[model samples]
Target: MESLPEETSSSSSTTTSGGGVGCGGAGEKLPIRPPIQPPSEKYSPLDWSAYFDQESDVFIPESENVFHVYTAGKEGPVVFCLHGGGYSGLSFALAARKIKQEARIVAMDLRGHGKSSTENDLDLSIERLCGDVLAVIKTMHGDSPPAILLVGHSMGGAVAVHVAAKKVLPSLAGLIVVDVVEGTAMASLMHMQKLLSNRMQYFPSIEKAIEWSVKGGTLRNIDSARISIPSTVKYDDSKKCYVHRARLMETEQYWRGWYEGLSEKFLSSPVPKILLLAGTDRLDRALTIGQMQGKFQMVLVRHTGHAIQEDVPDEFAITVLNFISRNRIGPNGVEIPGLRRPMQSQQ
Candidate 1:
């Protein structure tokens, strides 16, 4: 489901930490000194507070479910973000910094991920996820909800389409799906188990996990990995290391359900939409045809993997700001300068 991890290079320089005895002014014979090994680079875990302005748990009334959320910006349209499988809300941390200036952001850790607590945490059904989003939004904003633009990446993209198709959010103003296509996602499901197996099962520390996520191709940006990967793992007392927070292997039953009919649902949703991809090759028959007819805006961001937002957060944020500005979909409804107009829709 993701591109092969990009190779990273490191260099080591030998340094003498200890001084060896040599020929002094007394003309003593020089002694042989053993070689000194260079120290390994150290990776450190970053705090979420550095990127996001706030973090809170939205407790659903009359239920044990408590969804963890991160937010920034005080005004403008609310961009509700959903992260991919195995990722937490912090996945959007880097992008939030650039997005907050133009609009508000609300990123949530879906059930079974991060600090979220739910009765049946393993239930990743599309329907269950949709309901969770609606419930949380209602609890957070109530009847007078602010204008909302739903943004999702990978598996979260599929969920976003389904949620928008339901047409429940009266204030829903826009949709932006990042690096996910129905055809590609469905086809990739067969190899998903193998991909999951290849990942390191445990790490000695959160820093190591972050390091692996960057070098292993799961994430391309180390800064993004630093802020995001920590939330995706928990300290395992039994193994004495950090392990994945979500049990992805147990939710195999819901994999297909997440992506099936994604294209049709996304195309049918009546709203201004944008599809952002790492490469145009990901476009399927439906999306390709739809793009030809100007059904939705398609943007290609080169040199990125599946985690487009995390891989190139600054660019991702600008694309989003341009989308919002082009459609005039924010609370202030102001157009951003230099952004092109939306493509003409086919009648």
Candidate 2:
């Protein structure tokens, strides 16, 4: 298995027949015809049960909204995951399958996304999003919460930082923010609408949507896309096609709130934290200063897009497991055996 880099730095062959054939000449060699191949495996949607140990809705107390959650593994420190905008809990399906070997995963669908519902789903302001996460944790774990390692991606990363800053979850063990930086995210907000407008609004089937996601580079891993994309869309009886379950364009007003002040908050949180990014170029001013001060671990995962977890799940899992081991974190906040301490920085 490939290990993390020491520092935070960061093809098809065609075969052709050799013999040339003249027009029915006596010495002409016959052209070789390729034998029939088996039919291609359909890019069918995969069920949540295939990756997650259980799928259920946790009803928030004193509220009509119910959040859908996918849980994996029976034991170990809880790795609570929150998905990015326009994605669902299923986006972490592949990563959960691998990480569950060393830790439990609780990935939840945010309000207005996936199967999760709310009175005003579009109210995705930072405060409301944070409240949703806290509510779910309180309702599920009650007074006694397990040691949780919070992991979030993109918009979810912003939410994770805000949630951690609240310091409400006493058992919160650590934080992992993936491929999101406040400066970069805020700067990209202007172009988000154009990006959203350009996406295909409808698909003939879930398989087609998955295919498009892979081919269009929205998601590079086809297997991950097949399982995750299905949850991102819903069948439209009127249009006779599938449309995005969450209308991302409609939530444009909340985009800025998700990312503003994210870096400072992430650094201020009183917990061991790590920042995983697809490239070092995404680092903003605040993060660069924090990283220089050794405030948190910064990992650059090359060749991945924004969805680093789904793009390279094995690597992502190993990164998380290493984080847990390096921190000596175990189930229920105990020390795990046989885990090595992270190496010291030579520089």
Candidate 3:
């Protein structure tokens, strides 16, 4: 195993510009509108049991927040997934479905997003997010923990880096960071902010929400968007409309320093890591294929955007599986024998 780096200074600030809308794709022009207020009547809690094979909430007593976790597959190495900003655990639902038979998949909705409870303000911090992830790992593994793999996207990728840097999970096998990297450009960050800022807070119907999502250009994969958008919203009894469950303002505030912090954490991580970059040009050029050659593995998924898994589910799953198989360390932190799978050609 690689040794962790020494503790470093806190993250630095970056200049930000605000203009235009949409995450990475172009969309139709919509009328400017104010955000919709929360409903007067309490929201009807979503019953995900019917949608996912296993859906349950794990209460983190330390933070006093209940994290919604969705799991599939009865056995194999545990694969814990963390979704990006404004997304829920269901963001990985499609990919999870494809790899469930090979691994026990667990995806969680971070605090203030999806079905997770946002009861405390402490839940919004990066440290607390790392704590929540550790609690889940400890709870799931119990006395005998197997080699675990962490797969994260965007903001969640930062959280994963922090957790790995902390060295909390003794059974941790590898880290797979999607799209996000150490030196993300300010322009890209500003674009994401504009995209979130321009999003409609509520929709009159689920169909309308899907239509708006498609027109808004937040997601490239229409099928993935259709599944994820509905999962991120809940019907409001009083308003008779669907509203987003994520707290976008709070998330965006923390995202300002997320990249810098992730850089620090990445430098200190001891586990084998894989950085998956979308083949799009919108993301800033920071770390290159030549730079990470021996330190860590990097793969570029051609023609995909920030949401690599959603944009190319099968390819993403195969990439993850290949990485895990290649880096399957045992409980004592030694390489596992006779369990490796043959590598498939990269797409």
Q: Arrange candidates by lDDT, highest first: which order?
A: 1, 2, 3
Residue-wise C-alpha lDDT for candidate 3, range 1-347, written one tens digit per residue:
12223334432332123424522224444444443323221122334443357888887655567778998877777778999877888777778767776777789988778788856633467777887788776666664467778889988888888877776576677888888876663446768767666779778877667656545655666567666777777898988899876767656666666666565566456667788887545333335543354657778887666788877888888887787677764323334222232234489
Collision pairs in model 1:
5-217
Residue pairs clashing in model 3 are none
Clash counts per candidate, in order, are 1, 0, 0
Estimated TM-score per prediction? 0.85, 0.85, 0.74
What is the lDDT for 192 in model 2?
93
Which residue segments of model 3 deviate by more than 4 Å?
A: 1-52, 185-187, 190-193, 237-239, 280-286, 289-293, 329-347
Q: Give lDDT per model, in order.
A: 0.86, 0.85, 0.69
Cα deviation in Å at residue 128, candidate 1? 0.5
In the range 231-347, model 1's lDDT, one tens digit per residue, is 999999999989999999889999999999999999888788999998878999999999999989999998887898998999999999998888888673333232233334589
**Model 3 clashing-pair count:** 0
Worst 10 residues of 2 by lDDT: 5-14
lDDT of 1 at 156: 88
